[model samples]
Target: MEYLLFRLYGPMASWGDPAVGSDRPTALRPSRSALLGLVAAALGIRREEQSLHDKLAASVTFAVKQYSAGVLLRDFHTAQVPSQDKKTIRRTRKDELQTGRLNTVLSIRDYRCEGLWVIAIELTEDAGWDIRQLKEALLKPKFTLYLGRKSCPLAAPLSPKIVTSDCLRSALDTEFEPILKDSDADRVWLPKSDRVTYYWQGRKEATNLTGVSSDKVWDDPVHRQRWQFSSRTEHSASKHREE
Candidate 1:
């Protein structure tokens, strides 16, 4: 099997989870929707192009090797919101703040500090684009890409590569040079644990993976504009590196 591999490192990353009320939580690893959005942005696919987005979402699966989930960071934000009206659609934050009778809304946003992850992209039989095309897109993305939020910029290059491996696990195991030299390893924030975690979605037989656990997650993108997601099963495993 062929896979497109890439590295993502940033000072602040937020892999959003199912959010409710005033609290917005984040996952340890990147979500499926976030990965799809990253690739779509690289390809210059617009959010209004629902058909293309759906096609791309169905065309690929991902396996993430989480080297560092990073430490938890929270931000307290206060925004002005108009009266509750399901009929009202505010296009921008400015528009919302300008609306009649503004009310203060408090929100707590979560982020991971100096997170690092390696993503492996596996194509489906109905893939719209080949692995090489995806690699090229990442190399020269049409639109600027950020780790998660626009406020959180990438600290390093994606360093995308293509690897042909027998199984999904092997593809994820593919390595690249460290983002920083050995002397500068401690210059930035990184996890101290040698244990690596893997998260993927697919049949065990097809992926040739022995997952320690599996659970349903609601990160699968259904409609980007509407911010709708569907549930899918994700399998996970862990490995401790030997010195």
Candidate 2:
């Protein structure tokens, strides 16, 4: 088995936190969709091919490292007024665009700073190829990859190899723990668990992967929608290997 590991980092990455309405919520960590999209982009797939309407099968895993913690809140608003062209029964372009310009606002409810960290994305496959070759393929300077959202940027492609569950666990624990002093709050109040792990295995029905689900993926209503893809015969060899 070979896996491609990606290291995601950026000053400000939006992971779409769980929020309501059209207001987008940012993840405190990286996301599967963002990672999958990066892979698709690297493969030179078009936007239409990446749409949820198109099903693509690829497995992914996400490990979140929270070096900093801050509370987030969002708000939304919408209004419909009389159309400028009464006879046409259509709203003007300006009105439509500004209708909800400030529809959402985010504020950090709390503050905790950890500073630096790393999140590993393990993309596994049964392909009979060298992991080093895959890593080399990803290093193409023109290759543009994103984390969960367009705003999130991956730092670099890291070496990928078979990782033991224990090793993964230790890495998460060591880097995520905050050094609390006795003077700190009695409860120490660490950032909401600060560590998350995900594992995705390719499934037949959709282009999306299945396996370990994340609260960020499932609990968020906006992410509840699933993507669909037509399994074309062109990639039959890859498909067969995955199966």
Candidate 3:
């Protein structure tokens, strides 16, 4: 019955993909994990806070509209790595902290430029943080809020507001317009029909993706000091202006 609306606009955004290696690919749209991470950071909740993450995941429902897919921009990077072992480290420490001689490694990160997505998060139950708390946190976040990566800072304010809607389509239709960038190539992917694609917890991707399905919560860092995700249900929705 209540939803929190916000906008994610950035010069460049890197919505992570399921890739697991040197080349960190990005998804076309923001992943469930990324959304949760944004909220946690805004609330100043540490990554080690597992219980908080679980509560947030279970208490709220998330949906995003891919207004602009943007163009893919690949960044070429050469970084130092441990000469000895360790699968890979996300951050490199000082030169002296290395356990062994540092080795130069090549890493590629993909990003989307001129991208914009409208996010609608609904409180499914009277659990976890309240919408008011979330709005306040976003306004004065303890930690810096980036689109998906720290390198890509948000280009605009979240401008979060509360709305009344039972479904994402109606919620969006009431406010959003399909604004595309100057470049037509960045047009968003469209379904066979003008339907908003939705992804909710435990929602299965039926023959039609418009349905909901269960998905992994990839942003959980507290369970173990590793990149892990627990199961959660999410929903998605989409519509084409031409239709």
Candidate 4:
């Protein structure tokens, strides 16, 4: 099978989490949701296009190999929320007349500094878009592509290429380097149904990073609506070389 390869590297990135609190968290690697979003943006698919989204998500499967996890950079930010025209404003006394009753909220956002990852996307025969189409769109995206946030832009070109591989493990190892040992390799999350069924393996590693992300991608294939996820298994395996 043919696999599309690309690399995601940036000075800073934020693969967001579903935490509703004073602080926003980020995942170590690119989440499945973000990957889907990247592709959708390339194809210029709006979030409201549920049918289109589901078709794409169901047709493509992805694998990621992280070269560097990067360091965490926490930032403190303050923002002022403007009062709505429909609501009566309570006058808070300030030194300047320009202070028209705004809510100043402080929030902490987490970022990954100097993060790097290699991505491989495989499409089925019934995929929404073919390999060439995907590569073209990515090279010339409909929208500006960012690592995970608008502020965190890409450090380098994606350099998307196509490779022949029997499975995800082979794709990663052939293009990149070897996974010396089990510990040296990161978990490659593969979407699944009842269970993960693939070839050439090792063991799953427990990590704080989770990939059952909240980024909604055509969650329902039938009706084409809502947020849903195909279960994934964090897989590690010995590296292989093509003959």
- Report clash pairs, candidate 1: none
Best by TM-score: 1
Q: If both were scored by lDDT, which would come out higher, candidate 2 or candidate 3?
A: 3
The sequence of per-residue lDDT tens digits that candidate 3 reaches over residues 4-85 is 8887888889988766678988876777778888988888878887778777776766777666767889999998766654
Ranking by TM-score: 1, 3, 4, 2
Worst 10 residues of 3 by lDDT: 189-198
Question: Which candidate gets the maximum lDDT versus the true structure?
Answer: 1
Q: How do all models score by TM-score?
A: 0.91, 0.46, 0.75, 0.68
What lDDT tens digits, residue by residue, belong to model 1 across residues 1-243? 788999998989999899989998999999998899899999999989999998998799998988889989999989877898888888988878777779888999999998889999999999999889999999999988987788878888999999998878778878788777888877765666688888988865444545478899999988998989999999888777551
Off by over 4 Å in 1: 85-100, 205-211
| Of 1 and 4, the candidate ranking higher by TM-score | 1
Model 2 TM-score relative to the real fold: 0.46
TM-score of 1: 0.91
Question: Which residue pairs in candidate 4 have backbone atoms (N, alpha carbon, C) closer than 3 angstroms, thus clashing?
Answer: 54-218
CA RMSD of each candidate after superposition:
2.2, 11.2, 5.6, 9.8
> Which has the higher lDDT value, candidate number 2 or candidate number 4?
4
